[model samples]
Target chain A: MVDLTHTLSPEFPFLPVEGKTFPFRSSPIATIKGDGVYANRWELTEHVGTHLDAPCHFAEGAMAIEAIPLETLFVPLAVVSIAERVATNPDTTLGAGDLMRWEKDHGEIPARAAVFLHTGWDVRTKEPGAFVNMDGAKTMRFPGFSDKAIEFLLGRRSISGIGIDTLSIDPGRDKEYAVHKELFRAGKWAVECVANLSRVPATGAFVFVAPVKVAGASGAPARIVAVW
Target chain B: MVDLTHTLSPEFPFLPVEGKTFPFRSSPIATIKGDGVYANRWELTEHVGTHLDAPCHFAEGAMAIEAIPLETLFVPLAVVSIAERVATNPDTTLGAGDLMRWEKDHGEIPARAAVFLHTGWDVRTKEPGAFVNMDGAKTMRFPGFSDKAIEFLLGRRSISGIGIDTLSIDPGRDKEYAVHKELFRAGKWAVECVANLSRVPATGAFVFVAPVKVAGASGAPARIVAVW
Candidate 1:
């Protein structure tokens, strides 16, 4: 089993929300010296670090994070590495051809499988600015899935969800976020800011995407893992 | 698959820490009416609702939430139901005899298994006062594991960790918190405030306890599920 989640801390980079930031505050509630127990109180955004985007995140009247089916949370993993393409162009988008190429190498992507786009973006976690990859024009740059790729997965392949190592499943600079719309329209969920995807096998890995069951919340932080 | 997690909300009952409360506030960052997306920002304690207690929660220099071994997070489920006993005495504690009774019915408690103490305390989640069970003297009433039971599990059975449907693995009134100390001394973890244990079978169920993976934090809110 490989942990595909980032250690959520104050330093972890979050998506550039206009009036929001990932606020993580921890203070000791109990200490070993004075009290027998040692514990902490943590306050942070539900979307901080590795997290899941429920269908409701992009589509109204869609399933909230808690409403996501347990069966869908555990599924076969299909990792498609786009590190080579992303190395040269940070804004590269993975299209349907990339999925087809991966399928050609390793059988069909089974229905209800959780497909992960591994762009090797996790290594930049230390450098928050680089990980966000914002340009002079204030547009973020990162690799993500294209509309055609998401459409194929949802319409044809019938995948459970899509996961990516980058911040979002849609390109960082995409103002429309068409990929999110297409995927969420089919009641699909997404796992974002995933870590250690390189260690997981492209096929046959069992992924567990466990999100905090926050009632009526659009999305919540999740602890994702894969085992082959 | 059974969801053993309580739905975290503002109304959910949290452990009473002096001058502390589980503050869960959510506001829509993006609304479908104005923006094309619907998302929210949440702020809450890592120990709120259902959560995992890392070794560092009691032992100094011990494993933090993020450092907990992935192998230890997923394991076989061993549940010992004490609903009847707990009904009569709110402060009832499961001892080695209870574990022996469970083993007698089923097989031995296997090594590296997640032993869960099912007290049916989750039924009171709706009644905050009853769920917390705070008395006139300011001591909370609840069912938990005794030191002997924890010792037996850790030394004899070599179990990975222990879980309970109550707010804490130690009785709420116990200022000493001996169960937590003993368990953490052996580098074992704990899952607290788990719900819906009645759905999970006593044996042959695979339990997945996934925490938020907060860095350097003693504990974190977790999503725990069991598959039979």
Candidate 2:
């Protein structure tokens, strides 16, 4: 068993959307010394940390976080690594050619699989500034799956979803977020900022994308686990 | 697969702790109509709808929500139905004798299992008035596990936790919450207001109590699931 979630806190890096920042915050509401029990009040953006993006995040009139089917939550995981390329070029994307090569070596991508791009990006998680690396023009840099790669997975492989070990499934420099649209338009979900993909094998392991059942929300932080 | 989670919303029944009420709230921060992508900001108390109580919730120095070991999350689910008894007595409690009877018929309770008391309380979820069932003196009435039952499970079986289909693992009328203290003191956890427990079998199905990894918080809402 392995946990692929980041511990959500105010200190964790959050993506600024449209110049607005919604950070994760928690404060003690009850304490053993004060109230004889412990609990917290938490506030967060739906997309922070290791979270699952419901189809409604980008696709119009799609299912919200609560409406996602339970049957699709458990899925076969296919790990495709781009760490070697990402080590030299942080701007690299896992293109369609990579998926083809993966199928050539590992037979065919299984049905109902969540193909995760292991960019080795989680190595920078501890260093917030490095994790959200931005160039001189204020554009972030990280490896992600190419839109064509996502299209192939959706059209040919019949996958349940795609996951990535980065801030977004689209390469960080992407301003259009075309990949998110493609995936959500097909009513498929996604996971972002996934951790410890290196521990999982290329195939055989299954994952549970268990997001908190928030009603009518675009997404929520999830506790994703893999078991064989 | 069965999702043992209740969708969290502002309308859900939340247990008031020491006269404080923390309600779940979600509002759209970005909408597809304006922002092209959709998302929401959510605020919640950790103990709200379908939540897990980390050991630290009562045990002063026990593990927090983020530090809970992954090994303990995947557990063999042992469903012990008390729905029949609860049908007549709304304030019924599942006693230790019930556990003995369960073992006599199904053999010894398995190690590392989550034993759930299905009280059929979820049928009243749509009615907050009856769900909380507060009396003139402001005392709530619901089904829960008896402290003796929890003590027996902790001592005799290497169990992960105890769960209930009602507002708490302790009887709703319990002012002292003795059952909570007994279970938490043993470094075990609990789930409250779990949904769809009746769909699970007596034994054989394994569950994953996947709580959102809130950093250093006492507990968090969990999306628990069972698979056969």
Candidate 3:
């Protein structure tokens, strides 16, 4: 089994917010000095660190994180590496052609499987500024799937969801978040900020995306693992 | 796969604290009506609802939630039902005798396997006061593993950890929290407030306790599931 989740901490960057960003605070709720026990309270956003974005994140009245089927959370994993391209162009978006090329080597992506885009961005997770990659104009930049790519994955392959090492399934520069809408509209979910994808084989790994079961919430932090 | 986690919400009871208790507050960070996206932020304790108790939760310099081994997180599950006793006497604790009886029916508890105690306490999870079951002196009463049972499991069987359907693995009335200390000192973990243990067979199921990967934190909320 390989852990495909980033350890959530205060340093893990949150998506740029206009008003109030989600907070991740950890304080000792009980300490050995006072309470004779050691425990903590974590107050954070549902989307902190490695997380799952349920359909409700984009589509109103859609299934929340709790409503996601247990069977769908565990699926065959298909990883497509685009690290080389992302190394040069941070705005690199995975296209349908990339999927076709990967299929040539890894066979067809099975139905109801999860497709993860490995841009090697997880290496920068420890450096919050680099992970977020905000430009001079304050616009973030990162790799994500193209709208056409997501549409193809949904319409042709019937995928359960898509995952990425970056903060979003859509490129940070995307103002409309087209990929998110396209995927969520198809009743699919997204797993973001996944770590250690390079350790997993391109095919044949079973991914477990276990999200904190927040009732009726749009999304929640998740612990993702892969077993072969 | 059976979901052994409860739906986390504001109504769910939190562990009583001297100053403040578990506060589950969720608000829309971005709404479709305003921001063209539906997202929310949540603030709560790491021990809220169904969660894993990392070794650091009790023992200093011990493994935090992120440091728990993946192999230990997934293991053979052994369910021991004491629902009848717990129904009549809420303070009933699982003792070494219970483990012996369970082994009598099934085989010996396997090494590094997770044992679950089903006390039928999940039925009260919806009722805040009933789940806490605080007496007149403000002492909470619930079923948990006794020190003898934990010692037997750790020393004799060399089990991975134990889980309970109550708010904690230690009976709420115990001030010393001896069970927690013993398990943590042995480098074992605990899954607390798990739901739907009755759905899983007494043996033969593989339990997955996937906690939110809070870096260096004592514990975190988990999504526990069992596959048969």
Candidate 4:
């Protein structure tokens, strides 16, 4: 049993959007002397941390959290670690060849599996500057998917979704977000900000990426877990 | 595999508060979109819909969402259905006697198992009005646990936590919230607003309730599933 979701708090570094202010604050709902009790009060964006992006985030009429089938959310999973490669190049993008090599080393990715790309990117979460990687140009730098990699997964593999350790499935410099377009167009989902992938076995575990049944929203925070 | 979470939407009701109001309403992120996108933007109180309450919800310095051990969150579960009784009384509360009778029918609840109480209360979710149950008095009436049931579960069972099909673990009319205190004091967590427990067997299914890793959060929306 391993928890792959990241902890969401006020301290969790959020995605920096230029010009627009991000709502990322959470306060404890204090108890009144004569009133009732309910503990926390959260005031933040839907996509704060460890969240899932629905097609509607980019493409309209895509599947939202509630409409995604339960079977698609819970499936067999395979974790392919590219930590060493990502450690060397923060802007590194994983491609199909990389995943093929991973499959060669581990085993075939089963049908209906969630292919998790473990880049060891989450270790830097505590260091806000490093995690978000805000540069002088105001653009961020993070390891993500190569356009070809996403295409390969959807076109060739029998997969339900792809998960990554970084904030976005596409590189920070990717303004087009081609990877997201491909995955969403293919009727698949993406899980982001996953942690502790190193703790999971390469295969034989079931992944549960249950997002909130938020109606008509583009995306929602998901609490993903892997059951062995 | 059937999903048991309520869809959180703009129309999905939340616990009311006596505070200054705003004309602009931020809609909840719709969970499912077509063509493989789900919830791009979600807005809700942490305690809304299908959620898990950590001990830190009321017991400060206690376990936060991330601090609770994975073993505690991912244990084997036992479903104890009180739906038949709840059908007669919407305010029916589960007590020790109910649990004892359940044991006779389904055998003893194992130590550290997640005890899910299925009250058939979720039928109202199809219609928002009955789901929130806001009447002229503004008080919600729903099935939940009696204080005595809370004491019995904590004192007699080495259970991981309790799950309920209603909006809260306590009766909506509960003023003191003794159930919350009793469970939190014992370092137990909760799964609320769960559905489809009636589809699962009374025992043998494993309940997975993994919430977003919210730091110091009393609770967060959880993606719950059952594997038989």
Instruction: Give me the TM-scores of chain B across the candidates.
Output: 0.97, 0.97, 0.98, 0.88
Residue-level lDDT of model 3, residues B143-217, one tens digit each, is 899999998898789788889989889998988889999999999999888999989999999999999998888
Error in Å for residue B132 of model 1:
0.7
Q: Which residue ranges in model 2 land beyond 4 Å of their true spot?
A: none
Sort every candidate by DockQ, greatest first. Answer: 2, 3, 1, 4
Interface RMSD of 4: 4.5
Best by DockQ: 2
iRMS values for every prediction: 1.7, 1.1, 1.2, 4.5
Please provide, for model 1 over B65-147, each residue's C-alpha lDDT reduced to its tens digit, 9 standing for 90 to 100.
Answer: 88889999899999899999898999989989998989999989977899999999999998888889999999999989999
| lDDT of model 2, residue B61 | 92
Off by over 4 Å in 1: none
Q: Which lDDT value does model 4 have at A5?
A: 81
Writing each residue's lDDT as its tens digit, candidate 1 over A79-130 gives 9999998999999999999999999999999888999999999999889999
lDDT digits (tens) for residues A62-164 of candidate 3: 8899999999999999999999999899999999999999999999998889999999999998888899999999989999999889878987897888999
lDDT of 2 by residue, A7-76 (tens): 8888888786665456788888878999898888888889999999999998999989889888788989
Report the Cα RMSD per candidate.
1.4, 1.2, 1.2, 3.4
Q: State the TM-score for model 4.
A: 0.90
Between prediction 1 and prediction 4, which has the larger TM-score? 1
Q: Give the clashing residue pairs of candidate 1, or none.
A: none
Each candidate's clash count: 0, 0, 0, 39
Off by over 4 Å in 4: A19-23, A32-38, B20-42, B132-139
Alpha-carbon shift of residue B51 in model 4 (angstroms): 1.4
